[model samples]
Target: MTTHRRLVLALQPDMLAICRLEPTAYIGNDVLNGNFVAITKTDEELSIICPQENMPEEAIYTKGWRCLRIEGPFSHDTSGILASVLAPLAEAHLSVFTATTFDTGHVLVKEENLNRAIQILTQTGHVVRSENKATVPYAIQ
Candidate 1:
Protein backbone atom coordinates (compact mmCIF):
# COMPACT_ATOMS: atom_id res chain seq x y z
CA MET A 1 0.00 0.00 0.00
CA THR A 2 1.23 3.51 -0.76
CA THR A 3 1.54 5.98 2.08
CA HIS A 4 0.17 9.42 1.31
CA ARG A 5 1.72 12.51 2.82
CA ARG A 6 0.16 14.30 5.76
CA LEU A 7 -1.71 17.51 4.88
CA VAL A 8 -3.04 20.62 6.58
CA LEU A 9 -6.70 21.45 6.17
CA ALA A 10 -8.64 24.56 7.12
CA LEU A 11 -12.16 24.24 8.49
CA GLN A 12 -14.38 26.84 6.86
CA PRO A 13 -16.53 28.93 9.20
CA ASP A 14 -19.90 28.55 7.57
CA MET A 15 -22.46 25.82 8.07
CA LEU A 16 -23.25 24.64 4.54
CA ALA A 17 -26.16 22.90 2.89
CA ILE A 18 -26.21 20.48 0.01
CA CYS A 19 -29.10 20.92 -2.38
CA ARG A 20 -30.52 18.91 -5.25
CA LEU A 21 -32.69 20.56 -7.88
CA GLU A 22 -34.16 19.49 -11.19
CA PRO A 23 -31.61 19.07 -13.94
CA THR A 24 -32.46 22.41 -15.53
CA ALA A 25 -33.42 24.42 -12.46
CA TYR A 26 -32.31 28.04 -12.41
CA ILE A 27 -29.51 28.84 -9.99
CA GLY A 28 -30.23 32.16 -8.39
CA ASN A 29 -28.00 34.93 -6.97
CA ASP A 30 -28.30 33.74 -3.37
CA VAL A 31 -26.11 30.73 -3.96
CA LEU A 32 -23.63 32.72 -6.01
CA ASN A 33 -22.84 35.07 -3.14
CA GLY A 34 -21.83 32.42 -0.62
CA ASN A 35 -18.34 32.32 0.89
CA PHE A 36 -17.91 28.94 -0.73
CA VAL A 37 -20.26 27.50 -3.32
CA ALA A 38 -20.10 24.64 -5.79
CA ILE A 39 -22.67 23.91 -8.46
CA THR A 40 -22.80 20.94 -10.79
CA LYS A 41 -25.37 20.01 -13.40
CA THR A 42 -25.71 16.56 -14.88
CA ASP A 43 -28.44 14.84 -16.86
CA GLU A 44 -30.22 13.73 -13.71
CA GLU A 45 -29.81 16.63 -11.34
CA LEU A 46 -28.46 20.07 -10.51
CA SER A 47 -26.51 19.81 -7.27
CA ILE A 48 -25.49 22.81 -5.23
CA ILE A 49 -23.28 23.14 -2.15
CA CYS A 50 -23.41 26.51 -0.45
CA PRO A 51 -23.88 28.25 2.88
CA GLN A 52 -27.09 27.06 4.53
CA GLU A 53 -28.55 30.56 4.68
CA ASN A 54 -28.21 30.95 0.92
CA MET A 55 -30.05 27.81 -0.11
CA PRO A 56 -33.31 28.24 -2.01
CA GLU A 57 -36.56 27.13 -0.35
CA GLU A 58 -37.58 25.07 -3.33
CA ALA A 59 -34.47 22.89 -3.35
CA ILE A 60 -34.32 19.59 -1.49
CA TYR A 61 -31.43 19.93 0.92
CA THR A 62 -29.51 18.57 3.89
CA LYS A 63 -28.31 21.23 6.25
CA GLY A 64 -25.61 21.57 8.95
CA TRP A 65 -22.56 20.33 7.12
CA ARG A 66 -19.13 21.73 7.95
CA CYS A 67 -16.41 22.01 5.30
CA LEU A 68 -12.76 21.13 5.62
CA ARG A 69 -10.59 22.63 2.87
CA ILE A 70 -7.31 20.99 2.03
CA GLU A 71 -4.66 23.69 2.00
CA GLY A 72 -3.22 23.85 -1.47
CA PRO A 73 -2.81 25.40 -4.87
CA PHE A 74 -1.23 22.08 -5.79
CA SER A 75 0.03 21.45 -9.27
CA HIS A 76 -2.37 19.59 -11.49
CA ASP A 77 -0.06 16.63 -11.66
CA THR A 78 -0.04 16.16 -7.90
CA SER A 79 -1.93 13.14 -6.62
CA GLY A 80 -3.17 11.43 -3.46
CA ILE A 81 -4.09 14.65 -1.66
CA LEU A 82 -7.77 13.85 -1.31
CA ALA A 83 -7.38 10.13 -0.90
CA SER A 84 -5.09 10.64 2.03
CA VAL A 85 -7.75 12.56 3.88
CA LEU A 86 -10.73 10.54 2.74
CA ALA A 87 -9.34 7.07 3.36
CA PRO A 88 -9.11 7.70 7.06
CA LEU A 89 -12.60 9.07 7.28
CA ALA A 90 -14.01 6.15 5.34
CA GLU A 91 -12.27 3.69 7.62
CA ALA A 92 -14.01 5.31 10.54
CA HIS A 93 -17.39 4.87 8.86
CA LEU A 94 -18.02 8.54 8.33
CA SER A 95 -19.88 9.64 5.23
CA VAL A 96 -18.53 12.68 3.43
CA PHE A 97 -19.50 14.88 0.52
CA THR A 98 -16.60 16.13 -1.53
CA ALA A 99 -15.95 18.85 -4.07
CA THR A 100 -12.82 19.98 -5.84
CA THR A 101 -11.84 23.39 -7.11
CA PHE A 102 -8.87 24.09 -9.37
CA ASP A 103 -6.77 24.74 -6.29
CA THR A 104 -7.93 22.33 -3.58
CA GLY A 105 -10.37 19.76 -2.27
CA HIS A 106 -13.22 20.31 0.16
CA VAL A 107 -14.84 17.67 2.36
CA LEU A 108 -18.11 18.20 4.11
CA VAL A 109 -19.11 16.09 7.09
CA LYS A 110 -22.37 16.48 8.95
CA GLU A 111 -22.15 18.93 11.85
CA GLU A 112 -22.61 16.21 14.44
CA ASN A 113 -19.60 14.35 13.11
CA LEU A 114 -17.25 17.32 12.91
CA ASN A 115 -15.33 16.73 16.14
CA ARG A 116 -14.90 13.02 15.60
CA ALA A 117 -13.81 13.62 12.04
CA ILE A 118 -11.16 16.10 13.14
CA GLN A 119 -9.92 13.65 15.73
CA ILE A 120 -9.66 10.89 13.20
CA LEU A 121 -7.78 13.08 10.75
CA THR A 122 -5.37 14.25 13.39
CA GLN A 123 -4.75 10.69 14.54
CA THR A 124 -3.78 9.82 11.00
CA GLY A 125 -1.24 12.68 11.04
CA HIS A 126 -3.23 15.31 9.18
CA VAL A 127 -3.60 18.73 10.81
CA VAL A 128 -7.04 20.37 10.90
CA ARG A 129 -7.22 24.05 11.87
CA SER A 130 -10.21 26.26 12.19
CA GLU A 131 -10.73 30.04 12.20
CA ASN A 132 -14.11 29.38 13.75
CA LYS A 133 -13.86 29.75 17.51
CA ALA A 134 -16.59 27.18 18.00
CA THR A 135 -14.28 24.44 16.77
CA VAL A 136 -11.26 25.55 18.75
CA PRO A 137 -11.99 23.23 21.68
CA TYR A 138 -11.97 20.22 19.42
CA ALA A 139 -8.59 20.92 17.84
CA ILE A 140 -6.26 18.08 18.70
CA GLN A 141 -2.68 18.59 19.73
Candidate 2:
Protein backbone atom coordinates (compact mmCIF):
# COMPACT_ATOMS: atom_id res chain seq x y z
CA MET A 1 0.00 0.00 0.00
CA THR A 2 1.26 3.48 -0.81
CA THR A 3 1.15 5.94 2.05
CA HIS A 4 0.40 9.52 1.14
CA ARG A 5 2.35 12.21 2.93
CA ARG A 6 0.05 14.50 4.86
CA LEU A 7 0.65 18.24 4.42
CA VAL A 8 1.50 20.14 7.60
CA LEU A 9 -0.34 23.40 8.27
CA ALA A 10 -2.09 25.47 10.97
CA LEU A 11 -5.80 25.27 11.78
CA GLN A 12 -7.96 27.95 13.36
CA PRO A 13 -11.09 27.28 15.39
CA ASP A 14 -13.88 28.69 13.27
CA MET A 15 -16.70 26.42 12.22
CA LEU A 16 -18.61 28.05 9.39
CA ALA A 17 -21.73 26.79 7.65
CA ILE A 18 -21.25 26.19 3.93
CA CYS A 19 -24.22 27.94 2.45
CA ARG A 20 -24.66 27.59 -1.32
CA LEU A 21 -26.03 31.01 -2.05
CA GLU A 22 -26.99 33.14 -5.01
CA PRO A 23 -25.36 36.54 -4.60
CA THR A 24 -25.97 38.88 -7.50
CA ALA A 25 -25.10 42.43 -8.47
CA TYR A 26 -28.79 42.95 -9.11
CA ILE A 27 -30.52 41.26 -6.17
CA GLY A 28 -27.57 41.24 -3.76
CA ASN A 29 -28.13 37.82 -2.18
CA ASP A 30 -30.51 34.93 -2.08
CA VAL A 31 -29.92 31.98 0.25
CA LEU A 32 -29.95 28.67 -1.53
CA ASN A 33 -30.82 25.43 0.19
CA GLY A 34 -28.59 23.47 2.58
CA ASN A 35 -26.52 21.17 0.40
CA PHE A 36 -25.39 22.28 -3.08
CA VAL A 37 -25.87 24.91 -5.78
CA ALA A 38 -24.66 25.55 -9.32
CA ILE A 39 -24.04 28.65 -11.42
CA THR A 40 -24.17 28.71 -15.20
CA LYS A 41 -23.71 31.34 -17.85
CA THR A 42 -26.27 31.85 -20.60
CA ASP A 43 -25.70 32.31 -24.35
CA GLU A 44 -24.15 35.72 -23.81
CA GLU A 45 -22.09 34.41 -20.91
CA LEU A 46 -24.46 35.91 -18.42
CA SER A 47 -24.16 34.14 -15.09
CA ILE A 48 -27.23 32.50 -13.57
CA ILE A 49 -27.63 30.49 -10.38
CA CYS A 50 -29.59 27.28 -10.30
CA PRO A 51 -30.22 24.37 -7.98
CA GLN A 52 -27.38 21.84 -8.22
CA GLU A 53 -29.58 18.87 -9.19
CA ASN A 54 -30.32 20.46 -12.56
CA MET A 55 -26.62 20.57 -13.36
CA PRO A 56 -24.45 17.75 -14.69
CA GLU A 57 -23.00 15.04 -12.51
CA GLU A 58 -19.54 16.39 -13.23
CA ALA A 59 -20.50 19.52 -11.39
CA ILE A 60 -18.41 20.29 -8.34
CA TYR A 61 -19.48 22.01 -5.12
CA THR A 62 -18.08 25.54 -4.95
CA LYS A 63 -17.98 28.05 -2.07
CA GLY A 64 -15.77 27.16 0.85
CA TRP A 65 -16.33 28.69 4.29
CA ARG A 66 -17.74 27.82 7.74
CA CYS A 67 -14.55 25.97 8.60
CA LEU A 68 -11.91 26.00 11.24
CA ARG A 69 -8.33 26.16 10.06
CA ILE A 70 -6.35 23.46 11.86
CA GLU A 71 -3.50 25.47 13.38
CA GLY A 72 0.19 24.96 12.74
CA PRO A 73 3.33 23.23 13.93
CA PHE A 74 1.70 20.88 11.47
CA SER A 75 3.42 17.72 10.33
CA HIS A 76 0.89 15.47 8.63
CA ASP A 77 1.94 12.02 9.82
CA THR A 78 2.91 13.15 13.31
CA SER A 79 -0.05 11.78 15.26
CA GLY A 80 -2.98 11.71 12.84
CA ILE A 81 -4.47 14.88 14.35
CA LEU A 82 -6.17 15.70 11.06
CA ALA A 83 -7.85 12.37 10.83
CA SER A 84 -8.75 12.56 14.50
CA VAL A 85 -10.56 15.81 13.84
CA LEU A 86 -12.51 14.48 10.90
CA ALA A 87 -13.27 10.91 11.89
CA PRO A 88 -15.66 11.65 14.71
CA LEU A 89 -17.89 13.94 12.70
CA ALA A 90 -18.18 11.39 9.94
CA GLU A 91 -19.20 8.79 12.48
CA ALA A 92 -21.73 11.22 13.90
CA HIS A 93 -23.29 11.32 10.43
CA LEU A 94 -22.44 14.99 9.97
CA SER A 95 -21.25 16.17 6.58
CA VAL A 96 -17.85 17.84 6.48
CA PHE A 97 -16.79 20.50 4.04
CA THR A 98 -13.09 21.07 3.53
CA ALA A 99 -10.51 22.93 1.45
CA THR A 100 -6.73 23.22 1.49
CA THR A 101 -4.72 26.30 0.79
CA PHE A 102 -0.93 26.23 0.49
CA ASP A 103 -0.63 27.08 4.20
CA THR A 104 -3.44 25.19 5.92
CA GLY A 105 -6.47 22.91 5.78
CA HIS A 106 -10.00 24.21 6.32
CA VAL A 107 -12.60 21.79 7.65
CA LEU A 108 -16.16 22.92 7.08
CA VAL A 109 -19.06 21.38 8.97
CA LYS A 110 -22.69 22.44 8.82
CA GLU A 111 -23.79 25.45 10.88
CA GLU A 112 -26.05 23.19 12.88
CA ASN A 113 -23.12 20.88 13.45
CA LEU A 114 -20.71 23.63 14.51
CA ASN A 115 -20.95 23.19 18.27
CA ARG A 116 -20.74 19.45 18.18
CA ALA A 117 -17.84 19.61 15.73
CA ILE A 118 -15.92 21.98 18.01
CA GLN A 119 -16.64 19.81 21.01
CA ILE A 120 -15.43 16.74 19.13
CA LEU A 121 -12.28 18.51 17.98
CA THR A 122 -11.53 19.70 21.49
CA GLN A 123 -12.18 16.31 22.98
CA THR A 124 -9.73 14.81 20.52
CA GLY A 125 -6.85 17.18 21.52
CA HIS A 126 -7.14 19.62 18.61
CA VAL A 127 -7.60 23.24 19.71
CA VAL A 128 -10.49 25.44 18.46
CA ARG A 129 -11.90 28.95 18.82
CA SER A 130 -15.16 30.26 17.46
CA GLU A 131 -15.17 33.60 15.64
CA ASN A 132 -16.31 36.63 17.77
CA LYS A 133 -19.95 35.63 17.95
CA ALA A 134 -18.33 32.77 19.85
CA THR A 135 -21.66 31.10 20.37
CA VAL A 136 -22.62 29.80 16.89
CA PRO A 137 -19.28 30.53 15.15
CA TYR A 138 -20.32 31.22 11.59
CA ALA A 139 -22.35 33.34 9.14
CA ILE A 140 -25.86 32.20 8.26
CA GLN A 141 -25.92 28.49 7.42
Candidate 3:
Protein backbone atom coordinates (compact mmCIF):
# COMPACT_ATOMS: atom_id res chain seq x y z
CA MET A 1 0.00 0.00 0.00
CA THR A 2 1.11 3.54 -0.70
CA THR A 3 1.42 6.11 2.08
CA HIS A 4 0.52 9.80 2.00
CA ARG A 5 2.50 12.65 3.51
CA ARG A 6 2.94 16.34 2.79
CA LEU A 7 5.34 17.50 0.05
CA VAL A 8 6.54 20.94 -0.95
CA LEU A 9 8.46 22.14 -3.99
CA ALA A 10 11.90 23.64 -3.43
CA LEU A 11 14.82 24.75 -5.53
CA GLN A 12 18.36 26.05 -5.23
CA PRO A 13 18.78 29.81 -5.52
CA ASP A 14 20.93 29.86 -8.64
CA MET A 15 20.18 28.24 -11.93
CA LEU A 16 22.01 24.96 -12.70
CA ALA A 17 23.88 24.91 -15.98
CA ILE A 18 25.30 21.54 -17.06
CA CYS A 19 28.39 20.70 -19.08
CA ARG A 20 29.85 17.45 -20.36
CA LEU A 21 33.65 17.70 -20.28
CA GLU A 22 34.84 14.26 -21.30
CA PRO A 23 35.88 12.22 -18.22
CA THR A 24 37.53 15.18 -16.53
CA ALA A 25 34.78 17.76 -16.21
CA TYR A 26 35.34 18.98 -12.64
CA ILE A 27 38.86 17.84 -11.83
CA GLY A 28 40.88 21.05 -12.15
CA ASN A 29 40.98 23.86 -9.61
CA ASP A 30 37.94 26.08 -9.57
CA VAL A 31 38.77 29.25 -11.48
CA LEU A 32 35.71 31.03 -10.16
CA ASN A 33 35.67 31.36 -6.42
CA GLY A 34 32.59 29.48 -5.17
CA ASN A 35 30.69 29.75 -8.41
CA PHE A 36 28.43 26.82 -7.37
CA VAL A 37 29.17 24.26 -10.02
CA ALA A 38 29.42 20.52 -9.49
CA ILE A 39 31.35 17.95 -11.46
CA THR A 40 30.13 14.53 -10.49
CA LYS A 41 32.66 11.69 -10.35
CA THR A 42 30.21 9.42 -12.04
CA ASP A 43 30.52 6.91 -14.81
CA GLU A 44 29.04 9.56 -17.08
CA GLU A 45 30.73 12.88 -17.82
CA LEU A 46 28.51 15.68 -16.58
CA SER A 47 28.66 18.89 -14.61
CA ILE A 48 25.80 21.09 -13.51
CA ILE A 49 26.52 24.78 -13.47
CA CYS A 50 25.34 28.11 -12.21
CA PRO A 51 26.42 31.48 -13.55
CA GLN A 52 30.24 31.60 -13.42
CA GLU A 53 32.20 34.61 -14.65
CA ASN A 54 35.32 32.61 -15.43
CA MET A 55 34.07 29.68 -17.53
CA PRO A 56 36.43 26.79 -18.24
CA GLU A 57 39.21 27.26 -20.73
CA GLU A 58 38.30 23.98 -22.37
CA ALA A 59 35.20 24.72 -24.43
CA ILE A 60 32.22 23.57 -22.39
CA TYR A 61 29.88 21.54 -24.48
CA THR A 62 26.18 21.33 -23.69
CA LYS A 63 23.62 19.19 -25.44
CA GLY A 64 20.47 20.53 -23.77
CA TRP A 65 19.35 21.55 -20.30
CA ARG A 66 16.23 22.06 -18.21
CA CYS A 67 15.44 23.33 -14.73
CA LEU A 68 14.61 20.43 -12.37
CA ARG A 69 13.23 20.28 -8.79
CA ILE A 70 10.54 19.11 -6.38
CA GLU A 71 10.56 20.67 -2.94
CA GLY A 72 9.89 19.13 0.41
CA PRO A 73 6.94 18.16 2.59
CA PHE A 74 5.69 15.93 -0.15
CA SER A 75 3.79 12.67 0.04
CA HIS A 76 4.15 9.54 -2.02
CA ASP A 77 0.44 8.95 -1.70
CA THR A 78 -0.59 12.52 -2.39
CA SER A 79 -3.04 12.06 -5.18
CA GLY A 80 -2.33 15.06 -7.32
CA ILE A 81 0.80 16.91 -6.24
CA LEU A 82 3.47 14.75 -7.82
CA ALA A 83 1.27 14.06 -10.78
CA SER A 84 0.39 17.72 -10.91
CA VAL A 85 4.04 18.78 -10.90
CA LEU A 86 5.35 16.20 -13.28
CA ALA A 87 2.46 16.40 -15.72
CA PRO A 88 3.06 19.97 -16.69
CA LEU A 89 6.80 19.59 -16.96
CA ALA A 90 6.26 16.48 -18.97
CA GLU A 91 3.92 18.37 -21.20
CA ALA A 92 6.51 21.08 -21.52
CA HIS A 93 9.07 18.42 -22.47
CA LEU A 94 11.33 18.84 -19.46
CA SER A 95 13.29 16.22 -17.51
CA VAL A 96 13.84 15.94 -13.74
CA PHE A 97 16.26 14.71 -11.05
CA THR A 98 15.18 13.87 -7.53
CA ALA A 99 16.87 13.59 -4.13
CA THR A 100 15.53 12.98 -0.63
CA THR A 101 16.44 14.15 2.85
CA PHE A 102 15.13 12.98 6.19
CA ASP A 103 11.96 15.07 6.15
CA THR A 104 11.37 15.82 2.51
CA GLY A 105 12.00 15.15 -1.17
CA HIS A 106 13.67 17.30 -3.82
CA VAL A 107 13.24 17.39 -7.56
CA LEU A 108 15.53 19.18 -9.97
CA VAL A 109 14.54 20.53 -13.35
CA LYS A 110 16.66 22.52 -15.73
CA GLU A 111 17.82 26.01 -14.76
CA GLU A 112 16.07 28.02 -17.44
CA ASN A 113 12.50 27.04 -16.51
CA LEU A 114 12.71 27.21 -12.71
CA ASN A 115 10.72 30.42 -12.48
CA ARG A 116 7.92 28.98 -14.49
CA ALA A 117 7.98 25.80 -12.41
CA ILE A 118 7.80 27.73 -9.15
CA GLN A 119 4.97 29.80 -10.51
CA ILE A 120 3.06 26.68 -11.35
CA LEU A 121 3.71 25.16 -7.92
CA THR A 122 2.58 28.29 -6.07
CA GLN A 123 -0.54 28.80 -8.14
CA THR A 124 -1.45 25.23 -7.34
CA GLY A 125 -1.20 25.61 -3.51
CA HIS A 126 2.27 24.35 -2.65
CA VAL A 127 4.41 26.57 -0.44
CA VAL A 128 8.00 27.31 -1.37
CA ARG A 129 10.56 27.83 1.38
CA SER A 130 14.08 29.14 1.48
CA GLU A 131 16.91 26.95 2.75
CA ASN A 132 17.17 28.82 6.03
CA LYS A 133 13.42 28.95 6.59
CA ALA A 134 10.80 26.56 7.91
CA THR A 135 8.41 24.76 5.62
CA VAL A 136 5.77 22.17 6.47
CA PRO A 137 6.94 18.77 7.69
CA TYR A 138 6.66 16.10 5.06
CA ALA A 139 7.35 12.36 5.11
CA ILE A 140 9.17 12.34 1.82
CA GLN A 141 10.99 9.70 -0.17
Candidate 4:
Protein backbone atom coordinates (compact mmCIF):
# COMPACT_ATOMS: atom_id res chain seq x y z
CA MET A 1 0.00 0.00 0.00
CA THR A 2 1.15 3.53 -0.75
CA THR A 3 0.60 6.01 2.01
CA HIS A 4 0.03 9.60 1.04
CA ARG A 5 0.13 12.98 2.74
CA ARG A 6 -1.30 16.22 1.40
CA LEU A 7 0.43 19.37 2.52
CA VAL A 8 0.10 22.98 1.46
CA LEU A 9 3.62 24.22 0.91
CA ALA A 10 4.45 27.79 0.00
CA LEU A 11 7.75 28.75 -1.56
CA GLN A 12 9.11 31.94 -0.07
CA PRO A 13 9.61 34.59 -2.73
CA ASP A 14 13.00 35.85 -1.55
CA MET A 15 16.47 34.47 -1.96
CA LEU A 16 18.08 33.34 1.31
CA ALA A 17 21.53 33.00 2.81
CA ILE A 18 23.01 30.50 5.25
CA CYS A 19 25.52 32.22 7.48
CA ARG A 20 28.07 30.76 9.82
CA LEU A 21 30.09 32.56 12.49
CA GLU A 22 32.33 31.72 15.39
CA PRO A 23 30.53 30.45 18.45
CA THR A 24 30.99 33.69 20.32
CA ALA A 25 30.52 36.02 17.39
CA TYR A 26 28.14 38.87 17.97
CA ILE A 27 24.77 38.77 16.30
CA GLY A 28 24.59 41.84 14.10
CA ASN A 29 21.97 44.32 13.08
CA ASP A 30 22.01 43.05 9.53
CA VAL A 31 20.99 39.53 10.48
CA LEU A 32 18.38 40.85 12.87
CA ASN A 33 16.93 43.04 10.15
CA GLY A 34 16.29 40.10 7.86
CA ASN A 35 12.70 39.41 6.85
CA PHE A 36 13.06 35.92 8.29
CA VAL A 37 16.04 34.90 10.41
CA ALA A 38 16.90 31.73 12.29
CA ILE A 39 19.93 31.59 14.57
CA THR A 40 21.59 28.69 16.32
CA LYS A 41 24.65 28.71 18.56
CA THR A 42 26.47 25.49 19.20
CA ASP A 43 29.81 24.75 20.84
CA GLU A 44 31.57 25.01 17.49
CA GLU A 45 29.76 27.69 15.58
CA LEU A 46 26.85 30.03 15.25
CA SER A 47 24.71 29.34 12.19
CA ILE A 48 22.11 31.63 10.77
CA ILE A 49 19.57 31.62 7.98
CA CYS A 50 18.14 34.89 6.76
CA PRO A 51 17.13 36.85 3.70
CA GLN A 52 20.12 37.04 1.37
CA GLU A 53 20.07 40.81 0.98
CA ASN A 54 20.51 41.38 4.71
CA MET A 55 23.47 39.06 5.33
CA PRO A 56 26.69 40.68 6.45
CA GLU A 57 30.04 40.30 4.73
CA GLU A 58 31.71 39.05 7.91
CA ALA A 59 29.72 35.85 7.93
CA ILE A 60 30.68 32.90 5.75
CA TYR A 61 27.45 32.00 3.99
CA THR A 62 25.80 30.47 0.99
CA LYS A 63 23.54 32.68 -1.12
CA GLY A 64 20.93 32.03 -3.82
CA TRP A 65 18.90 29.52 -1.90
CA ARG A 66 15.09 29.47 -1.83
CA CYS A 67 12.75 28.21 0.86
CA LEU A 68 9.60 26.11 0.99
CA ARG A 69 7.32 26.81 3.91
CA ILE A 70 5.17 23.94 5.10
CA GLU A 71 1.88 25.61 5.98
CA GLY A 72 0.79 24.57 9.41
CA PRO A 73 0.32 25.14 13.05
CA PHE A 74 1.10 21.44 13.32
CA SER A 75 0.48 19.86 16.66
CA HIS A 76 3.56 19.30 18.76
CA ASP A 77 2.80 15.62 18.73
CA THR A 78 2.58 15.32 14.98
CA SER A 79 4.86 12.65 13.57
CA GLY A 80 6.51 12.04 10.22
CA ILE A 81 6.03 15.51 8.81
CA LEU A 82 9.67 16.05 8.01
CA ALA A 83 10.13 12.38 7.18
CA SER A 84 7.32 12.54 4.68
CA VAL A 85 8.84 15.57 3.03
CA LEU A 86 12.37 14.25 3.02
CA ALA A 87 12.07 10.65 1.93
CA PRO A 88 11.23 11.41 -1.67
CA LEU A 89 13.89 14.06 -1.95
CA ALA A 90 16.44 11.64 -0.59
CA GLU A 91 15.32 9.03 -3.06
CA ALA A 92 15.76 11.54 -5.86
CA HIS A 93 19.26 12.43 -4.54
CA LEU A 94 18.35 16.06 -3.95
CA SER A 95 20.05 17.66 -1.00
CA VAL A 96 18.05 19.96 1.25
CA PHE A 97 18.66 22.02 4.34
CA THR A 98 15.82 22.15 6.80
CA ALA A 99 14.78 24.16 9.84
CA THR A 100 11.76 24.24 12.05
CA THR A 101 10.10 27.08 13.90
CA PHE A 102 7.34 26.70 16.44
CA ASP A 103 4.65 26.67 13.80
CA THR A 104 6.18 25.07 10.71
CA GLY A 105 9.16 23.69 8.88
CA HIS A 106 11.32 25.32 6.21
CA VAL A 107 13.15 23.46 3.49
CA LEU A 108 15.86 25.10 1.43
CA VAL A 109 17.26 23.94 -1.85
CA LYS A 110 19.70 25.75 -4.09
CA GLU A 111 18.01 28.17 -6.51
CA GLU A 112 19.24 26.31 -9.57
CA ASN A 113 17.49 23.15 -8.44
CA LEU A 114 14.20 24.67 -7.29
CA ASN A 115 12.19 23.61 -10.30
CA ARG A 116 13.50 20.08 -10.23
CA ALA A 117 12.81 19.82 -6.52
CA ILE A 118 9.24 20.99 -7.04
CA GLN A 119 8.76 18.49 -9.82
CA ILE A 120 10.11 15.67 -7.67
CA LEU A 121 7.86 16.59 -4.78
CA THR A 122 4.79 16.87 -6.96
CA GLN A 123 5.49 13.51 -8.50
CA THR A 124 5.59 12.02 -5.03
CA GLY A 125 2.14 13.48 -4.30
CA HIS A 126 2.88 16.73 -2.51
CA VAL A 127 1.55 20.09 -3.61
CA VAL A 128 4.31 22.60 -4.21
CA ARG A 129 3.03 26.17 -4.44
CA SER A 130 5.00 29.33 -4.80
CA GLU A 131 4.46 33.06 -4.46
CA ASN A 132 4.04 33.41 -8.22
CA LYS A 133 1.76 31.19 -10.28
CA ALA A 134 4.63 29.77 -12.26
CA THR A 135 5.79 27.06 -9.87
CA VAL A 136 2.48 25.43 -9.18
CA PRO A 137 2.50 21.65 -9.28
CA TYR A 138 1.39 20.23 -12.63
CA ALA A 139 -0.12 16.82 -11.92
CA ILE A 140 0.38 14.43 -9.02
CA GLN A 141 -0.94 10.91 -9.52
Question: Candidate 2 residues 1-141, lDDT tens each?
Answer: 212333322333332222232333231233243232223343433232223233223333432234565655555546554566667667677788665444445666655666677666555455555444333322333
Model 4 poorest 10 in a row by lDDT: 132-141
Best by TM-score: 1
Supply every candidate's count of residue pairs whose N, Cα or C atoms clash at under 3 angstroms. Answer: 0, 10, 21, 0
Off by over 4 Å in 4: 1-3, 132-141
Better of 2 and 3 by TM-score: 3
lDDT of 4 by residue, 5-103 (tens): 777678887789999989998876867774467888999999999998888678999998888888798999998777777788788788899999999
Candidate 1 per-residue lDDT, tens place, 31-87, comes to 887678999999999999999999978999999999999889899999898899999
Candidate lDDT (C-alpha), each = 0.87, 0.46, 0.49, 0.81
lDDT of 3: 0.49
What are the C-alpha RMSDs, in order, of all predicted structures? Answer: 2.6, 9.9, 7.5, 3.5
Stretches of candidate 2 above 4 Å error? 1-65, 73-81, 131-141
C-alpha TM-scores of all predictions: 0.91, 0.46, 0.50, 0.88
Candidate 1: C-alpha lDDT: 0.87
Error of 3 at 77 (Å): 14
Off by over 4 Å in 1: 132-141
